[model samples]
Target: MKKYFLKLYQYNAWSNKRVLGTLQRQNVNDPKILSLMGHVVAAQFLWLHRIKGLPPPDVKLWGEYSLDQLLKLSEKAGKEWLEFVESNDNFDRQLTYTNYVGEPYTNNVEMIMVHLVNHSSYHRAQVAMLLRQKGFEPINTDFITYDRVITGQLKE
Candidate 1:
């Protein structure tokens, strides 16, 4: 499980760098793209906080981050997550938390970790679609595609 989380984190960092490079080259300053990225960051931060029993951040604050700032924030978050997984010894994966809507939710540690990755992937895909609509092709966010390109893996 730890290994899987690490792979997901690596994929996220690589994909983030790719998207940042694309946005820089295209000079994509679309407000919607920025907004979507902000949501992605907010979602990650919110879950991390939940996992750590920390208070949630103000979602509105994410708007203060420009694309470049968001990229840096994402990198920071990635590093923080890696350090967290490295340092934690408790392997008990079960924890429960309520959602923003006051709904009951139960998730083990592994499930929470997977949720973090999947949640970001989903929002990033939306951002990519938005970028394409605005005439910019964002980097592919597919996990297998990422592994194949980054590791030069041949299809079986």
Candidate 2:
């Protein structure tokens, strides 16, 4: 489970950098795209904080951040997730946390991790489409595409 989480986190970082690079090529003027990207990192931090029994950071869901700022935030989240995955042993460990609407829920580690990655992916797709609508071609951030680049023969 740890190895699986590590792989997912690694892939998440790789995909994030690709998307950030594409967004960086633009002038960082699109508020919609910026909010989506910012929310990715903000939600990651919020979840980590919740899992660690800490208060959420002063980041809003739709916060505006420049691409460079988001790049730094993305790197921070990746490093934190990698460390957490390596340190934790029980994937089924349960955690209780409150959502933005003050609704509380308990979830196992595996589910939380899956939700984190899937949430980012959902927003990344939105970012890609937003770029497309603006006459720009977004890079392919698909898991299989990343896998092909990292493992030419599918060694994993």
Candidate 3:
């Protein structure tokens, strides 16, 4: 499960970098794209910490940051997430956490992990659409493509 999530994370990081570069090269002036990426990262941090029974992250919204800065922050966040996964074994699952809507949810660690990936994937798709609406070419981030890139073969 960790490996799967890690693969998704790595692919996400790559896709974001591609989009960020496109925005930079095209000289995009809107900061909302960066803000959206920040939201994605912030949400991941909040959910992962919640699942791990840790304090939530403090980011309320995305802020202005150069592409390099955002990438660095993402790297840091990814490292923390990886460490959290490393500390837990498969038996440590089913954490209880509250959602923003004040609903109680009991989620296994693996489910929560997949949720994080899917959550990010959904938002990243939003970012891509937002970019396309603004006339930028967003990178294609299909999971199969990522697997092919990682394994050096076209995966079915």
Top TM-score prediction, candidate number: 2
lDDT by residue (55-141, candidate 2, tens digit) is 887778788887778999989988998898888887788998889999989998689889999999999999999999998878888
TM-score of 2: 0.92
Kindly list the per-residue Cα lDDT of model 3 for residues 1-156, writing each as its tens digit.
Answer: 656666666776666565566666776656787777777777767877787677767655455666666667676777777676656556246788887667988877777777777877887788789888988877777777777877879532
- In the range 39-119, model 1's lDDT, one tens digit per residue, is 777777777778888876665534756877878877877787777777776646777888777787878877778877887
The whole-model lDDT of each prediction reads 0.75, 0.87, 0.71
Minimum summed lDDT over a 10-residue window in model 2 is located at: 147-156
The Cα error of candidate 2 at residue 72, in Å, is 0.9
TM-score of each: 0.83, 0.92, 0.78
Clash count per candidate: 1, 0, 0
In candidate 1, position 64 carries an lDDT of 55
> Which candidate achieves the best lDDT against the true structure?
2
Better model by lDDT: candidate 1 vs candidate 2? 2
- Model 2 ranges with Cα > 4 A deviation: 153-156
